[model samples]
Target chain A: MKKIKQIFYLGIKGSNSFLAASLSAGNKVKLSGLASFEEIFRSVEKESSAAGILPLENSLSGSIYEIYDLLTDSKTFITAETEVRINHALMQKERTGLQKIRYCLSHPEVFRQCRRFFSDNPSIETVPVADTASAAKMLKELGPDTACVANPAAAAVNNLRIKKEHLEDNRNNYSRFITVGRKLKQHGNKISLMFNLKHVPGSLYKALSPYARLGLNLTKIESRPIPGRLWEYLFYVDFELNNGKHGFDEIITAMKMLTKNLKVLGRYDKYDKIKNS
Target chain B: MKKIKQIFYLGIKGSNSFLAASLSAGNKVKLSGLASFEEIFRSVEKESSAAGILPLENSLSGSIYEIYDLLTDSKTFITAETEVRINHALMQKERTGLQKIRYCLSHPEVFRQCRRFFSDNPSIETVPVADTASAAKMLKELGPDTACVANPAAAAVNNLRIKKEHLEDNRNNYSRFITVGRKLKQHGNKISLMFNLKHVPGSLYKALSPYARLGLNLTKIESRPIPGRLWEYLFYVDFELNNGKHGFDEIITAMKMLTKNLKVLGRYDKYDKIKNS
Candidate 1:
């Protein structure tokens, strides 16, 4: 078995994923870029020490249910959680002014996010690429009259000069990322779990009664639809353990008896704890 | 103010939205295609009789939270509910064999969904267009060698011939759509409401106890994060009142006093009920 000090993320270098991976792994582990989300999980699953960083949800866009579905299917377990503030910056090969650029290259989603910038500067023609990272890499390749919108990390990685900062329409946009490892972390202040309730009236309430009775703080709760089953849903819940893992085992034992197909996704501290530490 | 017998949707003719709008509005109303979701809501807000159809959730992709946010901000309410079985078909200007096709035009999402089809036939190059509807519109312009992936409706609308059906990798994929109108739907069995709690312990359980007490069946329950509020979330719950509008007024009065910012999004029947009737 091959083991390396590497963390995998989706997309090329200098993306929001790259930034989050860099932060989550810190300077100890090397960051590796993969083509797809599934590939990242595959790499981590193969090597136990390696980790995969996936953007699970965005403040504005909501949760990435595909990743949740992937997490359910994969043998990996969540170990850590982090947040990356999305800041899209416009850059070019040369230090050209906004008026000098004729073509602006970016992902279609990025273009939509920075809609106001283009509407204000109607002279710039928008070109959609596969991703923001590629857009930055293609800045010089496209020509001197072109600019690309990407993360500031991309500006450093691709050696492009920043023309504008915070180009997104909403400044409050943030993506919550999770680091998935082969083994679960047994210690943390918060725990994430998912379960399926039996098809009976008040089953949902009965399942939730444990948390309310034990005074467990449910930070997030959402029900996701099961594909072939039509209206039947899988519930994903996250709660904070106030007493610092006091009843972690007991809670798990209690929940296992109450719910069906109960899966403990992870145990981790909130983003604030990591930020403060 | 001018009002026409038109029901608006997001994309052009022959798209999934168009199919949903058609099923929702029936043959009496002319299905109109709009450029954006916001525009459709705006049009309906101006004219009370007019309605807009929006895709709310996909069995595979999950809920479109942006639409939920829009619903929270807008005056419109969900008047009806319908489901559209997503069927992507390969078509072209002429009835050409799969071997004759050189390029396939479709929305990037459609191309991703039909990844298996392209992988099986490596000779065909995928061209990512704006949408499936426009892909069909551009088929004749792109020539006989070029094929497009879209709904079967596009084949009839654009005067093209379908070469293959069920091109998507997952045949069971479905999108649930909701018709939003100016006034509340007064007589449907299921009711959708969203509320924010006062940040107290057991507030969620307390809010849910009402349902358990009455044995109300909760079809769907989801938590949507409020942007800029960090961890706070607004709960969206859909419950079926089996007694046929019995205690409807009393429950509204009871919940009004129990919850904060409680907004009754709509009253609508299940898709199965509509499909059968």
Candidate 2:
């Protein structure tokens, strides 16, 4: 039998990261929790875990910006990708009625998703906690008058009752997670890379023209500022190639000559299904 | 005598928006406070105020995403722009020492800017409040063991003693603010616009080539997702035009033909100096 792989993610049980790590490829996967994204990357660097899972972007919120910055600065590469549908639940202790709840606690991002819910219940005060699962844990300790907005999995793990399900205003909420490892894995059609261009007119256009010339489909383009350099940006681009890696080397060579500090972050297959089991 | 213009901003006295509103070009600027960004925009639309002041982006924390989304969705136009240097200070009740500060309250973004301070003092718990000024107001009511991270103006307004000045990790921290009004102001060197482009290989490059071809200097480019569209993005671009609206009409006409849903958000002069008074 193959040995189980150790995977580390941010937050405790019933968190979105936990769910994402569980879905990552491995016959027998052992998931561990870390306090911050920095610690997760450090653990991967230390070789304590085979891989680390992190949320890259959300369909509702534009991007998990801190993760983008970390990916740009770190040495790790994405090995795989997965998507999970976010379904937030309003949970509390048993026998707590809707009118009895006065405060709602959860992650700040979670609160943003449930804006309409809070607007409907104007009396309930929003309290920002560490994460969704920890908020559920804290809600269990608090009085019956308090509730938490988290996933149903978190409510079950913390022994709380779900008063309202699918509290997010948008029903099509989804988040994309990436598995990070030490070495680059090359079994995918999609490639993600980051590069810096000079602050000049049409510099980005010239840098991105290679994709169009080569008939590759560009999926996403995001720009983040370089630390200490005001107005200078590091552009992250994701593209899909249907053909084999025939002209990939030449394209990358030409791209490097056109742009500065070009780094290929990952080449991974895009996974969109939610594997709850 | 010229009539005073009523300008609304976010937060109470001594907030960054308050300072930005004061800098608006009016004979006598009558500044008012609003609880949220939506309220400020609504007040501007209702004609209760001549304009609204809002922070567009920060050098450290990137863009104020909500404002970006609001600008894309609303019909309001930018009248002026200003830059404010962020100098966060740690403050508490009279004579409270650093050791006595068991908890520090401020906006989540402010906490991010002061990461080094919190890492050095790990024992101090960070409490997320509404905003920096409100945190100072809350700290005044809380016990003496609590402190808040805000600007010196907030500390002075709330009667709190500044224990440590310049708490932000980066000394060059600055935020750009824009004044929003019903009509577009003409006296400006910069023009900001937003448009949507298809997810094609050279879609963005083609949309931006007009600027380069017309000898216009592009200042900034940011992309935000369209609400229901999964992969499509609305690109926000800022460019400087040296010639006085000479070829601007032709450029806009060509840009509209190349891009989808092109909208000119504003035209305003860029302000970079610190004008606290």
Candidate 3:
């Protein structure tokens, strides 16, 4: 039994709600703290943790690049992954009815996440809060006249009543969360690397050329702005290969000679579809 | 004289801080209402606006694509342009010393605007408020312990005192604000367009090849996800050319069949720098 005492998360209010449910579902990992990106990184650096969960990307808003940067910056190896289906529950204090709810409090992302819901209900004012959790906290503190569209967890934590559930217009809405810890765990079938190729034209194509020849399917290729480099970028990629294989070695060798700052984060299993019993 | 009574803005908090200063520079144009991107568009659709100011792009944070979409979605035309040399002032209630400040409030954009500032002062927690003006509003409501990095106007509006001025890490920080109204004011000489090319290999290059050949310098190119079209994008571009014998007609001709849905919002001159004098 892994006595997972502390799990640090940098996420929205609903993230905490979902996390609480997840933690309870698993080995009862104790909720130690909730911090923003910077704070969370600082804490992880100082202490050991069972897992640190952070949002990597959203379906609608594209990627949350900052979180990705932090993951690389801290050198914390991604240990596991989780996917929480986002159901942005529109809620207020139990006392406040739908008519009395004047303002909708949410993080800008949450407001965006629930764009269709707001478009359908254009009469109510939607105010961007700092985070979904903070909005939930504020609603609890400010009371019923103000409703919030956030995660079920946020409503649970903040003690607000959900007036409406699954308010996110898209039923397939989901955010991918990555769990990182000190030790690298090999799932034995994936390679994730971040690198910057020389910025000449076709450099991206050139870097991927070797992989293409080997028939290695590139699962993900994301470009993030390299600090201090104008228009140049560092690409984080997840390719379907392991460190031990001969083909993987050839590709890695070619990539190293062909790019700048080639870093191998780890080899992990590709997250296939979630299974249900 | 035009009695421009209302100003509608599609921005997060702190976004209008610089503009707030400009608006406070006179008493004529009052901020009638504040709303998100969707609300602002709906309001403008129902009636004409005095001036609608929206942050078009940031040097560091790329472009605000939603605003561009709003511009395209409506018949409102770009009338004037302005640039605010951003100075993120850290403010708290008058008497609160810097050491006493625990939580920092600002828009997420402003938080990114002043990332280094917060990093250097690690003890202070950052709370992303919705609007720069609202950050000030929150600072005033929360009082001394909370400081915010916002525009001087926000400080003035909320009656908060500037604990420290020019707190943004980047000295060259500026945000371009576009003033949209019903008709082209014949002031701005630069034209902005939104269009999309076929999503084929070298398609982007082919689209821009004409601009490079014609000696037309592109001021900006930003990609916005085409709604419901996975991975497809609409490119928002600003091309600089005087409407003269050098007829933009050539470039228009080049783009005639090359791109899809090419709509010229309006042509206007780059703004004269706003003066405190």
lDDT of each: 0.81, 0.77, 0.64
Instruction: Please provide, for model 2 over A1-277, each residue's C-alpha lDDT reduced to its tens digit, 9 standing for 90 to 100.
Output: 1132788888798888887776675767778998778888888777834688998876544566577667767878887888777888999887576888899898776776687889899989999775688888887778888999888778777888889888887776677799888777656788888888877767877887787777777777766655457556778788787577445676789799889999988888866555532
**Of 2 and 3, which scores higher on DockQ?**
2
Second chain only: TM-score per model?
Answer: 0.93, 0.86, 0.79
Candidate 1 lDDT over A219-273, as tens digits, reads 8888876656654668999888868634888778888888889999988777773
- Model 3 over residues B1-277: C-alpha lDDT tens digits? 2445667664533446335325432576655445566576566556553666666654444455556667887877776666666778888887576678899877776776577778788889988766677777777678567788877766766677887887766565566677777665544457777787544434555566666555554555445435446446566667666445346667678886678888877677765554220
Each candidate's TM vs. the true structure? 0.92, 0.88, 0.64
Question: Which of 1 and 2 is the better model by DockQ?
Answer: 1
Q: After superposition, how far is residue B49 of candidate 2 from its true place, in Å?
A: 4.6
- DockQ score for model 1, please? 0.51
Q: Give the TM-score of chain A, superposed on the true chain A, for all candidates in the order listed.
A: 0.94, 0.87, 0.80
Candidate 1 deviant stretches above 4 angstroms: A1-4, A273-277, B1-4, B273-277
Best by lDDT: 1
Best of the candidates, TM-score:
1
State which docking tier applies to candidate 1: medium
DockQ of each: 0.51, 0.39, 0.13
Better of 1 and 2 by TM-score: 1
User: Model 2's lDDT to the true fold?
Assistant: 0.77
